[model samples]
Target: MARKAQTPDIGPFDRHSISLRVDHVRQLFQTLDPYPFTERDLDKDAEEFIVSWARELTGDGPIRIVIHLPAQEASSAEGRKLGNAVRRYFEERTRAVSLDLRECFRLGRLSLAIGASVLALCMLGAQALSQHSFPGSLQSFLTESLIILGWVANWRPMEILLYDWWPIARHRNLLRRLSVADVRIVAVSPDERSHPPH
Candidate 1:
């Protein structure tokens, strides 16, 4: 993760205002950074800054999220395309949590099954070999080996079933909260000033 940028002296903020913009080129998202940002991934950096600030201001209440754009930006075919792209990015992120969660569960179940089978096989082997002159040391070694292998097989499923999903769930929850915030777009007027539409 990149170090968070220092908050600029944006003084006298209205409690309901958090602003960002996309400098669209034929409907593409552009960097909202004011200046001095490096060429590498400036768009994402600016977005992260906006989201970070939004989260910072959230003190047990909903804060505003604003996107500034020219009036025509939302009406153009290209603008619609850009909106779709943004939608896909967020949708994919949210979807990934569930997909990974399912995979974890699947892997956990598989591990448990394998562990149980290994233990059962060990028990059957020990019983069958009991009639033979099985060396006591060799029997102990075989039993211990099977126990270790069974534990290794069961470990992943236990971890996945018990603990792995919490972080993903938390992340998804954060995204969900951010998505539902009061997001507004201030229309940039002819004089290049931003204002809410009448």
Candidate 2:
């Protein structure tokens, strides 16, 4: 299948708000050192910043920060002023990070349910085709193809669910562990071409 580039359905937020948030985050990140930050530092900094900034913006209640970053160069003094305002907002915020685990889990569960439904539909179609007195070879081919398609379809939703459950910090750790396991498996494989030399 030719994969179409999906235009993301951004919820509720307007371009201005998103731009503001991006500008804020960029300025916040700039306060830290270097690009391509490691997992540990990124996790720690993200948590600390989110918590502090949230508290400052919303004052001990649920808060969302909306930042705007213009695509064009900020040549005008007004643009620079707006950027500086975002920077100050981050600096003045509280220094705590908290995530609602329950909400994250709920989102994960919803994603899993959707993926399972898609897989279930694929299975049902295969079963229906099999019972229609089709030739044995054709039935087998259709069933196998449907199963493979279903598996591929489910992959992205499953990944999203996993990401929600793990969050950034935990996800990074999970990826590291998975990478190590992959390396070990490749090292132990006898066929260099089949498994490829690690």
Candidate 3:
């Protein structure tokens, strides 16, 4: 297996390289996909491995993906299309994640509207109860319950707006970076390809 490339200092920004070794370029793509090479999805394990490594990467450095394949396979027509296939896969993922983020925000907005309306009604109910004559303990309990229920109604919207969207947005950004990442294929000896580094 080819060793990971050392960090590059070509420009002001850093360059990070993520490397992997496989017996053939085809191993990097989903075998079940009937689409042509450039439009095919990446293999699930391969995609997960690449994305996990990307998430661990730091800095605003440019990203590159290096795939090591057997010399014979590396020089083949399929290998020539590997980079484009990888880019297209990630581009599709980026678009899908963008949709997820948009849907998340839409749900958040709708929930917020519902939550606010419920809260307003609850507050009004509590305020009306406060002015009515009732047993002291019962009145206190009802008022407190209304207030608590009102806040509870807002829980989903607050969670969606404040916390849930972050990871989705971050994932979308990650996929976008990977979609444009430079991809390089390195030729390796058959022996090295057979026993790829762990």
User: Highest lDDT among the candidates is held by which one?
Assistant: 3
Model 1: weakest 10-residue lDDT segment is 33-42
Clashes of each: 0, 8, 0
Which lDDT tens digits does candidate 1 get at residues 1-198?
A: 222222223344445345665544222234453432222122456447645665566443554455556768755564444434444444555577668767777887887788778767766766665556655588667766766765676677678778987877766655555544555444556565333332
Model 3 has an lDDT value of 0.84
Q: State every prediction's TM-score relative to the real structure.
A: 0.57, 0.33, 0.89
Candidate 1 TM-score, C-alpha based? 0.57
| Full ranking by TM-score | 3, 1, 2
RMSD of each: 8.4, 22.1, 2.8
The runs of at least 3 residues in candidate 1 whose Cα sits more than 4 Å from the true structure, single-residue gaps closed, are 1-19, 25-63, 70-92, 126-132, 187-198
**Could you tell me which residue pairs clash in candidate 2?**
19-67, 19-68, 19-69, 20-67, 20-68, 21-67, 21-68, 52-94
| Prediction 1 global C-alpha lDDT | 0.54
Q: In candidate 3, what are the lDDT values of residues 11-84, reduced to their tens digit?
A: 43344668877777777787888988778888888898888888878875777888877788888999988888
- Give me the overall lDDT of model 2: 0.41
lDDT of each: 0.54, 0.41, 0.84
What digit string (tens of lDDT, one per residue) describes model 2 on residues 1-198? 011111223443212111122222234343455433221122344435444333233222222233233333233343344434433333332111113445565666776787788789999999888787766588789988988888877786677666645554443332222222210000112242243211
Superposed by TM-score, candidate 1 places the C-alpha of residue 28 at a distance from the truth, in angstroms, of 6.6
How many residue pairs clash in model 2? 8
